[model samples]
Every structure is written in structure tokens, then in C-alpha cells.
Target: MKTSTELALSLNPAKPRCTQPRRWLAAIAVLSVSWPVLVWADCVDTRKATAAEVEFHGRAMAALVAALPPVPVGGKLQNKDSVTTLGQQCRGVTGDFNLEATRFYELNFRKAIVSVAINVRQLRTDAAGLSESYGVASPNRSAALRVNNVVWTVSGSDSPLRQALVDAMDRTRLQGWVDKPLPSVAESEALASQAVPAAVAVPATGAPASNASTVQTAPQPAVAPEPLREAVDAVNKLRGLFGR
Candidate 1:
């Protein structure tokens, strides 16, 4: 006698039912299609500041330094030697400078938030006196004058330092620091320029119920054609029909 399994297989020779594999494959295909859209939706565009922005910040810093009390003499003033001393003084003032810079950066570049720290140690005064006999005394004292490396930390989805620099340039009517010339308009006019446009909304496929507006309006009922008959015939027909 044949075994029970052999007898059963012989009775029903059709292919085995295996829906699990097909269901998994379909699920994977759907996931593959959807994953990219989700990733795209989450994507953000981040950009470094242009050279113009950097120059604008430098100019603004220079202006700030100019507005403050003049550097004192002897201690370190009015010569190449003064830059080191100036940096020392600037280091003292970095806390206040950073705060102001932070505020300025925010007001200008809303999308590109940034935190800035003025590194005064890197700045050096003019090196004009290097050739003179007195210049040989100390190698450390002769360097270029600067506010030092302005550590611009760009945070958020955008670069605020770049924005701040752009705004400051516009507001101050600065021009030609970068390769591009400033706009012909005044600072006020430049500020009145429009901001970046907002993104448009998109509908999802097979979402629980679409908004009613998407559905087309129902067409109005068509008017029936009048019966084809002369006026007298129509009247007679009506009279006959109504027995009047």
C-alpha cells in the first residue's frame, strides 16, 4: 500500500500555495518606493558663506574697532609692535564682541543661524617697522593687525553668518569688497527685497480621505428637446392627451 503522503500528493497535483513569499516581496517593493520620498522630504540644503559675506564681516569688525576708544601709546600703540598688544586688548573684549556678533548674525541670516567667537590671538598689527634697528628687539611683536580668526559656527538648516554678512553689507551700503559690486539701490531698498519663497504642499497616494475640493463637480442635467410639431398640432396633441 502507498504511504498516506504519497496518496495525498497524487490526488491533488496542482502547485503548492505560498502567499507568504509574494506578500513579503510586495511589502519590500512598497517600502523601496516610499523610503526615498520620505528621505527627500527630510533633506535640507546647507551652504557655506560666499567671500562677500566674509569681507562684509571683516569690514563690520573693523568699523566696530574704529568706533571704540583709541589704542593707548607706549604700552603698545601706533606701530607694528602694537598689534600684539592690541590682540591682547581684543582678547579682553572678545566676550562683548561675541555677544554683539551673535546678535548681528541672527538679525541678518535667519535661516543660517551661527555662533561666532573672535579669536584675538591670531591678529597682528602692521609689520612696517621690521627693517629698522628697533624692530630686531622682539620677533613676537611684529605681525599684522586683525580681529583674529572670527570663528563662525554655522548651525541650524542654514548658514546665519553668511546671512548676517550679506545683511550688514546691505545695511551699511558696503560695495566692492567682494568680486561683485553692491546693488544700485539704497540700504532701505535692498532690505525691502523679498525673502525665500515657502515650499508647496503635496498630497500622498491612497491617503485616508482626500480633501473634497479634489472631486469634480457633478454635471448639470441636460434639457430635453421639445416635441417636433407645429404650434397647432402641438396644441391639438396636448388637448387630445389631456382630453380637454
Candidate 2:
């Protein structure tokens, strides 16, 4: 005797359950066609950097810039003594910069040290010889200084958004900076104006300057130093030796 349920099934002949998977796949395919990629956030706006974010950029740049020091000096590339001196100098400078970076991370991410290092390196690398060694071969010292200055300015800003805006030039398009003028201090100020929140004051002069209620510009500590002048002159003489 056929039960009522069996009789209904026989009349209707229910569709196979396997078809559900196919239906799901079809829906997913439609969605994929409509939206091919997943997007977590839009780049529509900019804001201030958290303490952690500032530390991250500051430490990362410090590590990178530190690795660049002990710029290959003296022509005797084939001499063991010269190479040994270079190694020793590199080790010393790397350790010093790494210590500064660690302190910057532990502290409030103050950028003065990083900016000083970048500034001195900018001066050192102005000679084509030294610049070529770093693979940044730019003849224009002013241009290189401008690019370095902008990086130091924005990365240390209170706004992570402003940093991202300049990262396109400092990080991705660095090679393009060899012949072109990269972003300037004024340009970074413009970016900050747009990206910084209304509640937070933006620095008018740039980083190493207070972004507090009243902006104050401090003279760069790295400039006008007798040691820097001597170091730069010495490296320039080395370049003459190598005809760079």
C-alpha cells in the first residue's frame, strides 16, 4: 500500500538535490562577474596617524636609510685595507642609526634624527661617485636633497594619509627622481592640508616642526656643521681620485 507521502512524491517527482550546488555556483558566478575583486576600504579620504602608525613608518625608514650609510669612499676598491675600513665604518654607522631607530620607536617617533641622517647622506651623495655607488646616480644635489627632505617631512607627519600621498613618489617612483624634481616641502604641506583632520593642527613649515596649536619652525640641527663640511669635502676629493 502506497503511503500518502509516497503517492505525492510519485505525482510530483521531486527534482534532484544535486541541482542546489549548481544553483549556488551560478549565483556566485554572477556575483563574480558583477564584482571581480574584493575591496575592504576606499581611498576616498585621509586622516591622522595613530602613534603606532607613526612609529612604523619612522622605524622602517630609519632601517632603510641606515643600511645605505658607510657610503663607498676612497677609490681603492681593490685594496683590502680600503674594503676593511668601509666595512668597519658601515658597521659603526649602522649600529648607531639602528639605536636611534629603536629609540625613535620606543619614544614618540620624533623625526629629527632621521631627518639629520637623511640630510647628511643627501650631502654626501651629491658627488656623482658616491651617488652611483648607492645606485641613486643623480647629478643634481638640490634635487636629491628636495626628495629626501620631502620623505623626512611627510613620513613623520601626524597624518598617515599624508604619508601615503607622498609614498607614491618616495617609494614607487624613486627611480623617476633621478632626472625629475620629486615632491617638495611645500607640496607636502599642501597634502597635509587636505589629509589632516580639522581638529589636529598641521605644521606650516613641515616635519621636525610642531604640529601643535602654534606651529614653530626649528633650524635643522644637521646643517652648518663643521664636521659635515669636512666629511663632504673629503668624499668629494675621493671622487676626484676615481674620476667620478
Candidate 3:
């Protein structure tokens, strides 16, 4: 027979077996809480790395511009055709000047084969009655840079949309914009415009026949023949003498 205490201890259910399932459940709960933090941390790290990359690229682009010869005011370094394309894109863009600027920069600069290409992805405009009512200055801009595909940008300036561009090149440095091969449309038009028509000759009408020996030429009627008139008179006199 057991003492009351021993009986109480025995009756107390054997410590519920801590099975693998319970351990797994605890692990899952811990992971569920920690996973978000880990994910957030990873996201932060990625953003920081991207920010650094952009800053480096921005600096490089700035340096390239600084090295270039000065471009005369009103004279663009990029080609006129490229500028035309940029203008077209700008005209089509609605409301966001920064977006237009970014697109223009990307088209004119980033993809260009010059010494440097700066892509300004987003920018902030301080104008009333714009889409966003809360018009606080924000660093909501992004850019992709390529000096042969090595990227760069302004730090703390990353936006999924709307940005401005700052180019560091001069007209001479940007001359590559013109150096790019002319588009086929312009070339073909130029060729077509320059082409000349083949020459052809036509014969004149009522001119003297080339073979003159085939027909007697008529005498021009400008003057009567005096010798023929005298001969006719002499013949009339000879006829009168023969009659006598």
C-alpha cells in the first residue's frame, strides 16, 4: 500500500510525453515569429546594397561629365535624331515632368554608347494640384547607370517611378550621339532625294531633210532673176525679126 503523497504523485498523469510532433510545433512557432524578422533584415540588406551601387554609379557618371569638354549653351552633344525621340517621349508624358526627364535621360544617355550613360528613374516636383496632395520633398528617385554596364546612382534616391537626370558630359563628349550610324529611314530618304532622272533627246520637226540629193532644193523667193527676164525679152525680139 502506498502513502497518500506517493498515491498523489502516481495519479498525477505521467508528464505528457513530449513527442516529436510537439517539438516540431514549437520549432514552427519560433520560426513563424522569427521568419518575418529575417525576411525584413534581408530586404533591408538588399536595399542598402542597391543604394550603395547606385551611389557609386552616380559618382562615376559625375566624374565622366566633369572630365568632358564643355558643351556650348544651346548646343547639345547628343544627336538631333536622339533629341527628337526624347522630345517626342516628353510630349507624350502626362503630368510628371520628372518621369519625362527620366525617360529622356534613359533614352538619350543610359543606352547611349558614349563614355557614360546616366538613367534618372524618378524625381520630385513641387507644384500645386499635382496627383499627390501631400507635397513634401521626397527622395523618390531612381537611376541606372552604365559605363559599359557598370551601374551607379544617387544614394537615398530610389523610386519605382518618377525621377530626374543630371548629365556630366559636354557636347564634345556626347558627340557619340551623332556618331551612331544614321537610321535607315533618313538614309533612304536622302538617297531617294538625291537620285537624278535619265536624260533623253527628241528630234526637231520641219528642219531640212538630212539627205538633200534626193529632191531639188527650191530657190528662196527673196529676189526675182534679172538674167531670166532679159533672156525672155531677147527671145521676143528674135521672134519679131524672123517674122519680117
Candidate 4:
């Protein structure tokens, strides 16, 4: 038995052939308009951040990695040409940015984001101390804040689902308290000053939606794991930009 679609096509054979191209064109148009909206969807279930966002941050991370003069882990930097080497590395890493980006964000994206925050904190501390000790101008570069904004922007703004995903994936089970939102240096330090409070699950009982859990927290630890050695090196190089 011929289907209704097939029967209709037999009656107007050219109709299907002509409409095929039109249908494809319409789909392409719709996707172009809706693409950004989908990017704002939950990164956990949707995992649909805009490709531009991913590519941008991936390149930035890679470039930043390259800019620093390499100091051996806990060893002093021996080369003055570290920034030059890093610049070349940045180009190399960013050459096939899509693949580099996949490796960047697949497992270690959050850790990279956190590392930026930590470095920002450390830089602020260093700047403050330098200003005080040398009576120099404030060197607040605002790198941390910029990095936070970009991370959240590309990754997706915080929503309940996003936080829950953080909970589900975190090995530390810190998903409850962390909310996994990037913090300003003040927020970071304030969190570190107090003992952590417990995370509370909102009762889904007789509720319209199933989303549960409210995080309550006292403070974040003053320190994150030592900043990525490469990132820290990049931060220091910014000193030359400022003629420090």
C-alpha cells in the first residue's frame, strides 16, 4: 500500500523534489537563529555551549599557557625568552583549535576555570603586597574577573540544572555547597574564612518540578590547589605589559 506521502508525491512528482531543497534551506535558517538560544541551555544535559564560545576560551587558555616563561615546578625560571616560546606554543595549540578545545573542556574544563580564579586571587594578593611594599600604583589587572565572566558566558549561565549537574559529577560531592559558580576574589577569601555549611535538598514532595537541593555554605577555602604553573607564569608576564 502506498503511503499518503507517496500518493501525494505521485500526484505532484516535482513537489517533493522542489520542496526538498526548500525544507533544507528553512532548517538551516531556523538553526542559525536558534543556535545561540540552545547554547544557553543546560550544559550538563544539553552540553550545548556555542561552538564560538568553546573555541574562544580554548584558544585563550592555550595562548595564556604559551605566554609564560617556563619555570620548573617549584624551580626558578631560567630563561628570559619564556614569553617568546609561549607565544609560539600558543599558535601551535590554537592551530587546530577544535581538537585542542575538546581536550581542554572534556574533563578538565572546570578545573581550568577554577585555576583562572585561583590565579586571579593570587595576582591580586601579589599586587596588593607589591603596592604596599614598594609604594607602587595598584596593579589590579582584573584578569580573574574577566576570566570568570568568559567561563560563565561560554559554559552557560548558572541555573538550577547546572548546579545539580555540578553535584552529580563532582567527586568531592561538593556539588551541594559549591554551586560551582565562579567567585570574585573577595567572595573567594570570605568563603575561606569560615567552616563549610551543609548543602540542603529541597523537598520535591508535591512539587510542580523535580529540581531539588539548596546549597548552604559558610566559606570557601582561602586557597585552591596551587594555580596552574603555566597560568601563574602568564600572569607574571603581564607585569611587562604594565612596565612593572
Best by TM-score: 1
Candidate 2 wrongly placed segments (more than 4 Å): 1-113, 116-170, 173-176, 194-244
Model 1 lDDT per residue over 8-81, tens place: 98998879799999999999999999996675453344244344434444444443232222211111122221
Worst 10 residues of 3 by lDDT: 95-104
Ranking 1 against 3 by lDDT, winner: 1
On lDDT, the leading prediction is 1
Evaluate all candidate structures by whole-model CA lDDT and list the values in order: 0.35, 0.34, 0.34, 0.32
Per-residue lDDT of candidate 2, residues 69-116 (tens digit): 121112111111110001111211111111111112111232211221
What TM-score do all the candidates reach, one by one? Answer: 0.24, 0.18, 0.18, 0.18
Mark the regions of model 1 whose C-alpha exceeds 4 Å error after superposition. 1-58, 62-100, 104-113, 118-143, 154-213, 222-236, 240-244
Off by over 4 Å in 3: 8-15, 40-244
The CA root-mean-square deviation of candidate 2, after full C-alpha superposition on the true structure, stands at 31.5
Predicted structure 4: lDDT = 0.32
**Prediction 3 TM-score vs. true:** 0.18
lDDT (Cα, 0-100) at 101 in candidate 3: 11
Count of clashing pairs, candidate 3: 8
